[model samples]
Target chain A: MYGLIGKMRAARGQRDAVMDVLRETTGALPGCLSYVIAIDPVDADAIWVTEVWTDQASHKASLQLPEVQAAIAKARPFIAGFEFQVETRPVGGFGLPTAEPG
Target chain B: MYGLIGKMRAARGQRDAVMDVLRETTGALPGCLSYVIAIDPVDADAIWVTEVWTDQASHKASLQLPEVQAAIAKARPFIAGFEFQVETRPVGGFGLPTAEPG
Candidate 1:
């Protein structure tokens, strides 16, 4: 499955606000297996987003969903910067969907 | 729940070996809600492990499990370095268990 893990910064003193915006992304994002928003205990302004999807296209397509687009717009102001980003392929573990053989 | 997100580098030509070690960690970790091993698409030596547990104590206790201890020892040689580590509290998301009210 396609995976994305990234570190992001919230506007100064706005980490909680940014988290709220992300938490609202419970819209119908088909193929999205996991979309976790977590607070970084070490950095007040840092937040981590970890995502897993059935495929790359499913992930890309979710970006255009009206709800997702709206979330991006709403969260723009609170986003300060991104520290790092990486694309990944999930191997296996608990709480993840079983990957289908290609 | 307690959460941990970290980036790890595998020794040269041993990423898959390192992943195998981690993936074999499917032992009975009581409170481990999620433990995913993902490969970094951009870096051959980089891997990301995202984990969530019911509580801090559960996570801490897991380190002492025989299987986990064994895996750590087996993978130590192939483990090059840890790029970063962070503690977190998950707010909400899919593929995660609901947080119980305290």
Candidate 2:
């Protein structure tokens, strides 16, 4: 599976607002296995997003969706900056129900 | 539950080597729900690690374990640098089987 691990820094205390948009925006994409948004315990202004998709193409396609675009537009104002964006190939784990068949 | 999302840059083409160490090191710590390591698709020298634990204390305590400390020491040589480390409070999601009671 394809995975994305990244962090977004929100403006001042706007982290929750941005997280709301992210949670609302990430509707059921075709290949989405998991989409989790969490508040940074140490950095109050940071939000960490972890996503698991069936493949890289699915993740790319989701970005072009209208909802995603709208969400980006909505959250853009609160975003201070992005940090540590990395792509990954997920193997397997406890809560990963979408384990692809080999 | 507590979560950690971060990226580690490996030295030159040592990403895979570093990943191996990570996988080997993260062996069933108490309260550790998940520990996944993935390579950065775009960056050849980067690795992304996503971890979910029962609580912040568990994660902190794990770090002090002999095995964990040994793993860190073993992996340190290949680590180029760290980027985008964030602590998170996970709500709920698929594949995240360790969802705590509300």
Pairs with backbone N, CA or C atoms under 3 Å apart (clashes), candidate 1: none
DockQ of each: 0.55, 0.32
DockQ of candidate 1 is 0.55
Over the stretch B3-48, how does candidate 1's per-residue lDDT look in tens digits?
Answer: 9988899999899998888877754488987787788888999998
Cα deviation of A74, candidate 2, in Å: 7.7
**lDDT tens digits by residue: candidate 1, A7-68:** 89999999988888787775437998877878877788999888888899999999999988
- Residue ranges of candidate 1 with Cα displaced over 4 Å: A99-102, B99-102
Q: Write the per-residue lDDT of candidate 2 for residues A38-86, one digit (tens) a residue.
A: 7777778888778888899999999999888998999999999997676
Q: Give all TM-scores, in the order shown.
A: 0.90, 0.70
CA shift at A7, candidate 1, in angstroms? Answer: 1.7
For candidate 2, what is the DockQ?
A: 0.32
lDDT of 2 at A9: 95
Lowest-lDDT window of 10 residues in candidate 2 chain A?
A93-102
